[model samples]
Target: MYELHTDRLTLRGWRDSDLEPWAAMNADPEVRKHLGDLLTREQTDASVARFQAEFEQRGYGWWAVEVRATGEFIGFAGLDRVDDGMPFSGVEIGWRLARTAWGKGYATEAALAVLAYGFDTLELSEILAVTTSTNMRSQAVMRRIGMTRDPADDFEDPEAPEGPLRPNVLFRRACGARV
Candidate 1:
């Protein structure tokens, strides 16, 4: 299984038991604000299945993030192929956690490790992260992880079926480079 360790987090592949908490996170309105409408439990399960399949086939995907000290499933953070009609296409680093997990620096910590894994283990040339224009928290995390914002590269998300949330900010980091 793919696993990444940081001072307070463990990033690994998904588990069946993670479904409930993960779903709850996805279902939280506040957490889903920038992400648009909250996802149903069924939608969350499908997403988990897709992540697992991607990990198996591509050898990389969003890893299940856990609080190492408490053994709690915080959420997921790692590398994934954007695979959509966005400006950044080849690969990206992304994350999502429960509402209670916010403002804890967990996203930044886990993201750094995952970005390292992407450039080191996966030998990626670069990784990008995209978030809605209003999601300053995630934008800050992207900057904290050494990614630079590229307004010229911004594009609408083709995957988001829900309308206006499509316009997003694009952040990119080159391999072996740190901000």
Candidate 2:
């Protein structure tokens, strides 16, 4: 099993036990604010299945993040393939946590570890991050992790509906860059 350890968290592969909390986090409006809408349990399960498949096939994907000290399943943080049609196609780093896990710097901490894994371990030359223009919270996390925004890279998310979510901002960080 691929696992990554940070100062306060562990990023590991998905488990059957993570389904309940994962569903609840997906259902939380606050948590879904930037992710479009709340996902049904079925949708959440399908997503978990997909994440597992990606891990099995590619050896890495969105990892199920947990607090090291408490073993609490806080949420997920890792890398995913940017869909084929996206403007800036490449691997993207992302995270999603329960509302309780917010504001504690867990996202930044876990993201730093994931970034290191992607660059240092996986040897990826670059990683990107995307969020809706209004998602200042995630943008803050992106900035905290040393990702920089390139205005020309920003594009409307084709997958998002014709609304606030469509206008997404892009952030990028190259391997070996200071963070």
Candidate 3:
């Protein structure tokens, strides 16, 4: 298991024990608000199964974020490629945490670590983070990690309907930045 330990969080792959909590978080309205759609239990199972498969195939994927001290799963943060047609490709950092897990710096903290892994371990030249324009909270985190916007690189996300969230912001940060 490739597990990353931060001061307050643990980034790791999924486990059988994580199913129930993962389902609850996916079903949480607040957590799914910005995620485009809320996943039903069956969908959540399929999602987790896909995540597991991706990890086995690619050696990495979205990692489950847990508070090491309390052993509580907050959400997930890691690198994923946009499956929808887009202009660029490679690892892109992302996060989805329960509402209760927000307001803390966990997203920023975990993302920075993933950025480091992308540039160092994965040897990626650049990593992108995309979020709907209206998702100011996520945009702030992208900026917090020192990623700059590339307007010319913006592309329509096939998964997103036309709206504020549809106008995706592409934040790019190269290697050499602090993780």
Candidate 3 segments exceeding 4 Å error: none
Rank by TM-score, highest first.
2, 1, 3
TM-score of each: 0.94, 0.97, 0.93
The TM-score leader among the candidates is: 2
lDDT for each residue of candidate 2 in 90-110, tens digit (9 for 90 to 100): 899999999999999999999
Q: Model 1's lDDT to the true fold?
A: 0.88
lDDT of each: 0.88, 0.93, 0.83
The sequence of per-residue lDDT tens digits that candidate 1 reaches over residues 69-138 is 9989989987877775565577888999888899999999999998888889989998989898888999
Better by TM-score, candidate 3 or 2: 2
Model 2, position 88: C-alpha lDDT score: 69
**Considering lDDT, where higher is better, how would the candidates rank from best to worst?**
2, 1, 3
What value does the lDDT take at residue 38 in candidate 2? Answer: 93
Better of 1 and 2 by lDDT: 2
Q: For candidate 1, list the clashing residue pairs, or say none.
A: none
lDDT of 3 by residue, 65-140 (tens): 8998998888888888766477677678899888888889999999888888888888888898988767889989
Angstrom error at residue 60, model 2: 1.3
